[model samples]
Target: MGEKQPNEQLATWFVRSGWSKGELARQVNRRARQIGASHISTDTSRVRRWLDGESPREPIPKILSDLFSERFGSLVTIEDLGLKAVPNLAPGSGVDLPWNGSQTVQLISDYSRSDLMLNRRGFLGTSLALTAGSALIEPMQRWLAPAPASGGLPTGALATARGGRPPTGRISPPELALLESTVRMFRQWDAQNGGGLRRKAVVGQLHEVCDLLQETYPADVTRRLFQTTAQLAHLAGWMSYDIGMHPSAQKYYVLALHAAKEAGDRPFGALILSDMCRQMIHLNRSSDALELVHLAQYGSRDTATARTSALMHALEARAYANLGEVNKCYRAARLAEDSFTDISVPLEQEPDWITFFSEAELNAENAHSYRDLSYHAGRSEVYALQAQPVMERAVELFAQDPDHQRSYALNLIGMSSVHLLQKQPEEAAASAQQALEIAIRIRSERVNTRVRKTTAAATDEFRGVAEVIELRDRVKQELPEYTRNQAV
Candidate 1:
């Protein structure tokens, strides 16, 4: 037996009018239909099998050849059908185009489409770090710190509508339709499942909508849409981070931040900043994360919502905990708790974004913060127990709507980590394994990273167990290179 070459298959098809196997199958089915053959059928899977060198069932192969010959007005053989292979027929391996205006448009369109496809499942498997290298970052840095705007929006007209949609009109029909669709979709998914399943799609769709809005709407209308879109994008990015597409996720976060600024929503901007900082903490860049938290605090100062303030403080506590600054972590955690004291006030007083925050939610966050501090302080028992209840609550809340895969994944990771700390190796392994399965299904790097960390810790406690060792090894193999280093 020998390996079959792809080019050989492609070449066979080239001489027969360059029709692909799938195309040939369609032709065969069509010809069969003309002949009044009963039960005529063709499918991608069968065509793919033929392309892989399997012989066709019966009259199908000859029928396909005849159909192609008739269509092309010449003799067509199976060999000429290029069924074996072709020299340059690799999927997604097209030649690169020159960077220009046209290319940029194509890039944006293709990227959007790719994102849409990928979001339907999990994070796109490809790494964005290589693509978003220093080259991209340098320009982005320059743009972020542009000299005082000369009577222009911070990001220039990038945020404004170019001619696509008028900025005013009592919620134009199309705009209302779009808004309702987005809200309904998001709420439905959030309620039914969790963020894991819908986060990527939500974000990708929001980005696409934002792109369209920028191309069409007026400033005021665009700004409002942009704000909501940015929030969706932020959630998508968070889900991406949760699932494990750090590079692309970071890009989305940055874009969301810019969108938030354009909408003149400082609170939302601060919230995103806090989220970005949390990612840094996960990466062990605690010092850098601390700085980001400070920035978030500064940006959110004038925010009227107690929940928003509490969220910022909670983020600060996470950074401090990561830094091993127990006192600072406690102080920040306490600030977060105090902020929630006024959360019971009138709903109108709270910001739209922070309206989801409640006393139970704040308590859950506090519990997690304490657990983080405990981890840094080497108080395993206390950390394990303190984190248990809140983690349980999160799981319960998230499970109420199974579609929120991202939140479910996060809670699972947290619970797994706590179980590991309690030296419950079996329970820890089970939790970690479940999380890993979800992570793999969604192709999320963040969830994988968390699972890897927890599994490694658990493995140390059950070094002699074969199942534990095997699971640990599998997790180690699955984690990204960057995460492996951080876990160590």
Candidate 2:
């Protein structure tokens, strides 16, 4: 038989609806229940077949039609959803949305719907649902390319060519202040309370801000508006990452990148790139992370202030750490520290989003870089001991700030790892125990992840010690999957 035709139209609609095939299946079952019908095998597999152009028989076709119609907030038909064999319908195939306000609005709307409503996990082929339809990390030039003449944005907010003047219905100072304040609060909540608290509400707020940007504003206010929007997008991205939603997190980061570029805040754009580097490192794509660091460097260009420069090098140190390039990591670390010395007013003058980058963060990167280096060079007491003081200092700093509960907990775990490597099982257990206290109180899974690693280290090298064993048991109780990965 000849190959079956693919229905890109239905795929787009599926992405727009923010519904995964599995979600579609589940919704269909519920809608079926409303009609008092039972026994339908409307699983993801069946939905996949329909996407591949197999017609659904009779009632189910109409049922699917209704489901998508409600999701996209418009009429949909069996034909639209590929219930019948059909050709691609959405014009020439491409996922790139031209840089404009309406496109940006739709992007955020679809992303929010997918995240808040569908809570989608994997979207493999759809542009509307996943990165498949999104641009991968682009070069700095693409991001820093000339802004549109009209406010330098496709969604032109009439900017002042000379002295800044207010436009009618322009974004007021108070409104911009509120946006900045919201991002600040969200940042605090993310560090102290956990990203899970009202994250969906933040996404909702992003939509509101996105709507605000659609309107024209003064040149000065527009710049501030873009800056504010970028920060919120970054927050949305960070929260999504904290909860293990990698795809959604990446989308938010990309949106943040665009917003920063649109704002013409070169420093903020570099910051976004640095943030992306961190995410890439987490995903184990060190090479990609390195590229993002370079992009960040280029984005900063000549106008990079001392604080921004410090952050860039510090972020580079992290990527180097991931690559196990010890010498390069050290070089970057030194540059970061040196750059910090040049900053004026330091954290007080730095952007709120980046104000948290201090000695503690630098120390953490050092500890991680050295730990990774030791893995390849053969473990040494000297290596472990050196990392200890850095981690201890970091832990001290984070611990003093109660709102940074998760960071404090993870740093404690980092300290415990060094102690473990040095054969100080008692110290290791105590440090891990302290970390556990914070982990239990916070909602971050990442904090739990660190504790699990600490538990693994304790059990692997010092199984005979009672305190170590006790620590392991407690960790297992806290994270049920903690029992499965005991490998060193």
Candidate 3:
């Protein structure tokens, strides 16, 4: 050839992946989105240009390294692409786990520092591939293999333990108790308010907790303190996801998992995995979600309480529903239902976090599982018929708890959508209006989004029937102000 190709490495991967230039471009665009890139316009021409001697920019090269690394089972970097690299940069290896107490704490502390100080885009861009084999799998595998000891302090933890920095006092039980109560309060607020509004405060709270973790504590103190910290991090990660800050959510969840491992609490670790399943399911990564759900159940087999195990199985049902595996969904659902036989024990014995795993909550989860099948499996008629009754049951169960106004509201919305799928316009309108009333009162984007889904449903099915028209108009008219109130 008169001139050798500039990106022979990329070309080789393109061929090996059997991807067209357009396909490669598409993959890169999706990769860009994983890091919150909103304006990328990568296309076939971009790929061709890259292969024609034009080097990619700072993030693209880093992004491609992740893409090809996942694809080819090897680390492929900017230099590998035969392109001039960004000055003094190489592909980053992701979180390595299985370290003893010292290393694990250091890993999380360093992550928070980088998280707080680094450019948000670049920081998120690097960690987007946590789902890739190396980042998530290895750490989870290490955690699952053997539980570490319960209360080992980090190196020099004792010497640094005396200063309290939030407003300098030592990390004491009262301090730990305050964090616990704060997380508990946030949980109730999350139900009433939703994750979007509360996520920033939760993130800041987690930063404070991480600061406390840098200092040393005695064994019993470390155990309880770290466990509480893990819970706080999980809450922060969860709220981050609800706000749609997905990469940041992933970061906090990874930190939570590390802290949970350090706390030597297998059950809580399982719970963190279960919490992660929610984000994974929302992202449409059902395969990964399924893996996580099973991991949650298996990892906590010995330690997770019955209600907790039931919740894990229920989560598995949702993952299977996404995969269109109806039988598995029902099977896991039944196990979840069966796991709730004992419910009257002292709440303190179990993490108060699982308090939401009440009968109503399990029914709500089952309702979602059925709802998921109806939405995604193309067996809508059959599944919607099943989902309507389950959702109705969930509504009834929720009504038993006066404080459960949020889940009750959501379940009714779910029922309305199921009714619309089943072609019951009258029932759908009644349920939608009720849900709208709930949405009007709650400060939650999630509630509004659900109502909007019903609005879209009625609009799409336009028979110009008085009921459908009226319901659709009401939702559309109200949603604009409602969404503005919440999102803003």
Candidate 4:
């Protein structure tokens, strides 16, 4: 065999991380454990081999990329690490490319079609690497520019025999309204039920809408059609995320952002970016999430209504709380509350999408932010104590709506975490049991994920307790294998 070439790129990132070889091995193993890959144990010698130019297997390159991305608060792909020969462990789904409005439609059609195919094939995990939120900053900046006027469309439904090919069919206002109504129905279902039951349905609907976009319409109708398309794409993205198809979710979100821009709905675009920020936070990239939210807030400052502003601030609080910034978290939470109180628009006047950010939703965001704060505050139980009343109020409000089971279930998990932070094992277990009961009824993988995380915490805290043991057993039986593996 010839002499081996050193992996300079890997060596550079390793030096930048300032972690010893052994520490790198430990972190790799820990990350593997989080993903239920219990078999991935490496020692310092393995790390040395990697640095000495031996290409690691399928997951190590991906895992190292993720680790370095989180460490550097930016994207670090496999190619950046000089491990391009290893099969890419993550999926992108073409979200990183720059595309025009027509290209955006194609992207949506391609992504949703593949999503349906994967679902039909009984695929559980998506073969996608999530695009980092930080990587979206420049694209969002471009989206902030003024949208071009929707001119040059046919004035009436009749297709003019110009030099170009005519549209497939004419889209009327009634058709646009029907599509809008369908989006509303899908939104309500997603809110009440998790994304699993109807995700495929949403994707199918999105495909239909994309096809409709090819039809002829007046400028006003065309704008509304794109608006409806944006809404459908955003819902599809959220459902994808809810079902744990995270890479697909990221792609759909990028598509939604593009559609929203084409529709000239700056506020809605900001909302989509905020939702993307929440996903980043879930992926343990709070710094990137914080930056993304700031971009959203800044970009929509003029166009965002009071309700949208409140929701954005609440999400900002969530990112801050996850980052352990106590003061910033509370400050953003207070801003959210204040924004809600200052709403000048009537409930009926606000957009259909922002209408859901009512007082109950704000309270839920605050409750979650406070619960996260409790964990980050170290030994202090003050934040934990503060979380209870907010959580109680949220639970009370959410309980009033029986259809809002997923929200209710999530708050229960939050409440349980607060109880755990306060050293109330019995209360924590009780709340967790309640959450699990609700979670099993819901079809949301996100709820199942919460159950897994909470159960893992309960197990760690009350290792020998009968109730916690039973909770773990129930989770194993109810949740999927991936979730069950992570719960341990």
Which candidate number has the best TM-score?
4
In terms of lDDT, model 4 sits at 0.77
For model 3, name the residue pairs that clash.
157-216, 164-168, 164-169
Query: What TM-score does each of the candidates earn?
Result: 0.59, 0.74, 0.73, 0.80
Task: Please give, for residues 396-471, the per-residue lDDT of candidate 4 as tens digits.
Answer: 8888878678888988888888888888877888888898888877778778878888888889879888888888
lDDT of each: 0.59, 0.68, 0.70, 0.77
TM-score, prediction 1 = 0.59
lDDT string, candidate 1, 405-487, tens digits? 65567667777777767777777777777777666655344556567766766776788867678778877676544321121
Output the lDDT of residue 90, model 2: 50
- Please, what are the lDDT tens digits per residue for candidate 2 over residues 1-488? 87777667777787887788888898777655543345555899988877786666645765666566434433465666766423334521222445654455556656655555444222211122222201455433477667665545434454343334446555557867877898888889889866656567788788778777666666667677778778878888787666544445677877777677667777877887787777776656677778887888987779687777887887788778767787898899789889888877746776787777777777776676666556545776766776787788888888777778878887898888888778899999999999988877766655676688678868989999999999988988876531101100
1 or 2, greater by lDDT: 2
| For model 4, the run of ten residues with the poorest summed lDDT | 152-161
| Runs of candidate 2 exceeding 4 Å displacement | 1-97, 120-135, 139-141, 150-155, 159-171, 378-382, 480-488
Residue 278, candidate 3: C-alpha displacement in angstroms: 2.0
Q: Is candidate 1 or candidate 4 better by lDDT?
A: 4
- The model with the greatest lDDT is 4
Task: Give the C-alpha lDDT of model 1.
Answer: 0.59
